[model samples]
Target: MNIVFPTLRNGLFGAILALSPMLAAQAKTPADQLIVGMSMVNLFSIDPANAPGLDASGINANLYDTLVKRDNGNPERHVPQLAESWTVSEDGKQITFKLRSDVKFHSGNPLTAEDVAWSLYRVMKLNFGLATTWKAYGYNLDNIQASIRATDAHTLVIDLPQPTDPLLVIDSLAISPSAVVVDRKQALQHEKNGDLGAAWLVTNEAGSGPFTLSKWSANDSLVMTRFDGYWAGPAKMKRVLVRHMTESQSLRLMLERGDLDLAYGMAAPDIKAIERSDALQVQALQRGTMYYVAMSMKQPEFAKQQVREAVRNLIDYQGIDQQVMPHYGTLNQQPMQLGLAARLPDPGYTMDVAKAKALLAEAGYPNGFNTTIRILSEPPFIDIAARMQATLAEGGIKATIVTGTGNQVYGAMRARNFEMIVARGAERYPHPYFSLRTFVYNPDNSDAAGLPNFQGWRASFFNQQLNELIDRAGVERDADQRLKLYHQAQTLYDKQVGPIMMISQMTDTAVSAADVKGFTGDDAEATRYLGVYKQR
Candidate 1:
């Protein structure tokens, strides 16, 4: 709901806009604290290897540091935090990191190589630790596992099976302090009810980050305070609070009314009116935030490629983009470019009414059948589902929408719950793999926090090719050949409607005017908030 109102201006550019001329004119005052607002949608976890959602992105980024955080368009490059520097072998398979011996985890112990090795060990074994990329590299277990080793107290060497390129495969891995977890075996002993290590990371801060974890309640709230001995100066804010409610209407009503400093997890249009005045600013953390619907390829309804194509054509993309979310997004024309299918073409699902009818006829479904689509009880998605139902109706398909909350929705999805779903997550940074293969390529019943391969379409062959693509993407020195393989895989994905993907371009945060300064985003979605500094 963007509005245009002319403001009195003498210059062509309109007198350098200022929300508050008096405030801008006044001398800058450095405050002791910078309070950040957390309305909802913040997941609690400081482990970069496993931090998920808006809260985690905000909290963990400040609390932990990754080995390599990207600057901008540049590939995932290294910047000092725990490791002051590192060197890659000529073949690119091995990476030798020189640690910053001065740094210590919040637990009060110095960072060490043994911890680094254990941390890698933790990531290599997904269910046991905070590392979340298990689905991304689950099949290629050989890439990790025993691949990492600590040669000395301060030096760590990683041996890749081949010349694994840093640009593609492993971005900067956020090093975990050995002082905190000590050993992987012992760490599992701390798990509550023997679920996984994520439980420990939720309320505990074993990281070498700027802030220390104090308390946490899932979907409710999390708290953190500065680590006094943090190698970096103490954080400005005395404490940080986070919550995880994803209600837009409530968030917009409460936050804009001044009850909160910031709010998220909801896509309320209420801010449009406020932004027209000087009372608010929207800080979107843009990277590659993608959202989409996936169909069960194994289902009889969607077994035919033509049926998938026809259903795609029936999507009211223009109607949705133009009507409901005029400000939120642009039409995503390809799947690979967004969501878990990064680099694949969207086909815009082309809004061809006749072609859709013809394809349906060719598939012997000229009089589209009735079907139900699954979705989260979350907003925006509910709206999206309804919109899809309406548009599919126009294509002779009767689409019923079924919605549920949390585990209920996830459980159904896991069991091949519905013919379709409007699930969220993916389009992460550092590489396309982070955005894609983590789900679509290896999605199956074995996965927990991964894509629901419930449709039971296990194209092991496609995934195998995907693995070759991953290795080549990282290690191949020839840019041309690397692109060739990338394109080859991308082509196969594009030609098939395996997943109905829609991408959300970086809408992560709004870079504030309050000197929340530093490079805010990159090819990978990570924003190194520690690098951000207030202007002196």
Candidate 2:
């Protein structure tokens, strides 16, 4: 898929140009106005199932709803929207969710269990890692489609094909309104039109959630107003207007000029710029996300296992995080060890020029291996890739950065087109399963069961073990046993998997203090939208 982003440097991007005091003057607090510019480079579809990159997920947070929502304000807790409460069966195969009594579509249709079953089943059968959480949910379900049965109007009964743990999967997939689904056959018809039932829900609001999508002017802004019949009563803010601003300089300018109350998905370098100004304030979620460099398993250097190891031995995350992105970064962690498996491996490879040189020689690349890495056109991300290029150069890897919008890079990455890409990642939860399922494991099946697995890792030792361990994690719920299984998976992944990378230099985000409230802070992918409110 080809991708292109609009130039934020246009007159429209000039922050103070339209916000000058001489222009239309109005009395409003910074919190009263929320306008953001996303550098077109990172912009992706607002639809969850089709979102092209991490930024699209950010946009979907405002526009969509998920089942069994994660509390964005308090990441650890959950508050039901479509389903009020749920029960797990003894065998862990069946999950019965008790639906909320007073929920309706943003378009005013009463939500029901049939809608819930259809929504979950449709996502699973479509079979793209369609949604991150949905992918894991797909894996957990030996077959959820057959198991989903409506017990009553306000209840959803999901029988898992296997006894998989719900901690990671359920936390990630947001529940859509059952009233909207109506039936399974209709959703498939729309999926052909670039509209999952979720995307169609976009142009017109129809979920039993707080905000009703009032406007979605693509390539410009998206707007939402509070739902009056919302179970939570009313949101703190009156209306939420999400404008598109892709440039960091433009986003910072709007904030300084008082044209915006909050801005998120900021570039790493701009964090300091905003923090230094008294006119603006910032609050971070300590993202459960991470960014890394990846290679198509087929690349020559990566084709040789030892060459890949030499590359991993070469990344200086500590030095890069400090010098490049300047955000809070952990040198020893890959994006996988985070999310659900908080206690997973921290692969710490020190920056020893001599050792790196030694590894290169062992790999038969005494001179150096040349490579080109692709990435979205964001300054902070670009900085990280540049530093990586320099670091790899010192250890005998000549790397260059090729930048584009995420949609452009991600497609090529998936097709194994680029030698490497600076992959900025953060999962919706703290789970190893997410990483293993999506990035770590390469699914050879046409169904694409796990994810794009662009790294192309196919080590029998690693692949065989990971497949077994994921199953082991389901049956063995003893926290200790599950961890052992996870560790074995990690050891094989880190040492054998091809993409040797870092999590230090990546984008950091913040909300304008005045924009909105009631967000659950830690839930990955910012779930639990039933709790979100448009501050009044």
Candidate 3:
């Protein structure tokens, strides 16, 4: 990688200058490198088995390879990756993947079916991350090992313990980290104290992707270098340096100064201004990302369906869309996102303080109640929470807001330790099953289940009616029959009151220099960097 040294013209001032804000504004990424500025507090972890948030997952996507990959060129379609081809049993209980012979890991180890099987086993054995995703389909810690196995060097088979639609398993594995194949030999060689190299892999990568983790400093920066042995051929940019920048102004300045190639986290207003610059380009694709509020049914007040409905109806949807969400998102309330099957339009529930107050009174809280709403201390989320607070106050419900980093905010939600949380949910994979599992269905809500697969557990919300619908949807082979079951679940959720669906986000804007090529506007960061070349 190329490094540049700044010339100093003064004494103590020169030292200060080198370390000042100007350092961020003036520092230039090498021409052969791609530098990204983001507002994330810090990466949680890069290990696919443990990383919970999107930023970490995005980084991991570049370092790892999945057996199957989504076709970025065509949304919601699959393509072969580490696995060149596959076959499924007529009963749909078994899937066999044929591993590619030529793929090699960054550790220089040859790819094999053993690595694919071991990697998936590790995800379940570790009992975190995608483990919950697999659990929803009946794979458990005790049975996962037996269900997935390598019969030979080039062939791996996954036998579902229960009969279900094979598409469910295929889609789940395709987009989730559960499908990422690690270099088993390398990982086992570094294993320490029975940790299975978990500690070592946090900062290191042993996969077959185009880039390998070179360096990562918490709350500072993460640097990745292209793998010369990459199976698809070398990346155009030799290095990728992502700096932690929480401010949009700094990112704009750095880009204007030609210090950075792309800025990943820009507010809508900032993006508009940046678009006017002839040297820069901006693109936005409305993603299936949802921002909503969750109420803990554990609270006696929230347990009442009437109170939940009151809270849902108290928000001024049109006002927020016009004021807070302009250019950033659009209002969408369907349990499933639009353009997907069985999607219902917004129920047209409008703001009515009187109706909300009456409902709160009916729920045994005539004087309203006081509660806390947890939200990340960042743009749009905090601001949106404030708007909700105002509306709730109008209905005699007093809401105190709590703000923290994504980890602090989401951690509490995952642990089911909050009264309410202002959160965002997205269909990481383009499938109705993802949305159904994420928001409506939770097979096991206990902490022991590591229930990250579904938001139902977080809200302490469970309906046997909704659960049964999801279960039937899982096993139904007919597309029309499956969609009917999902529609039933949505109808049930509407009547019962689940999460307060707020807005579906539009493009997460990425501004880049004019010379950048092949950057895609996508919800999954994994697809964005693949095959993206710099046109320098």
By TM-score, the best candidate is 3
How large an RMSD does model 1 have?
8.8
Cα lDDT of model 1 by residue, 1-536, tens digit: 11111221122122123112442243432233233333333243445445544345656566665554444443444455566788877766677888777777766667777776776666545532234343233323455546676788788777765444554433536422111233244345576664346567556655677777677665455666767787877765556544444545444544444333344444646546445544445655544545666776556878788888887788777776666553445556543444332355544554677888899889999898888777665556677788788777787888777765544554565555457776655444425544445444543334343433212222211345655665456456676776676667666666666555563343444313334344354334434344444454
Q: How accurate locally, in lDDT, is each candidate?
A: 0.53, 0.56, 0.75
Least well predicted 10-residue stretch by lDDT in candidate 2: 175-184
For residues 372-391, could you state the per-residue lDDT of candidate 3 as single tens digits? Answer: 88876555776688898999
**What is the lDDT for 72 in model 1?**
47
Q: Write down the TM-score of every candidate.
A: 0.77, 0.82, 0.92
TM-score of 1: 0.77
Q: Which stretches of candidate 3 lie over 4 Å from their true place?
A: 1-28, 73-76, 500-502
Query: Order the candidates by lDDT, highest first — what do you get?
Result: 3, 2, 1
Model 1: ten consecutive residues of lowest lDDT: 1-10
Whole-structure CA lDDT of model 3? 0.75
Evaluate residue 283 in candidate 2 and report its C-alpha lDDT on the 0 to 100 scale.
Answer: 68
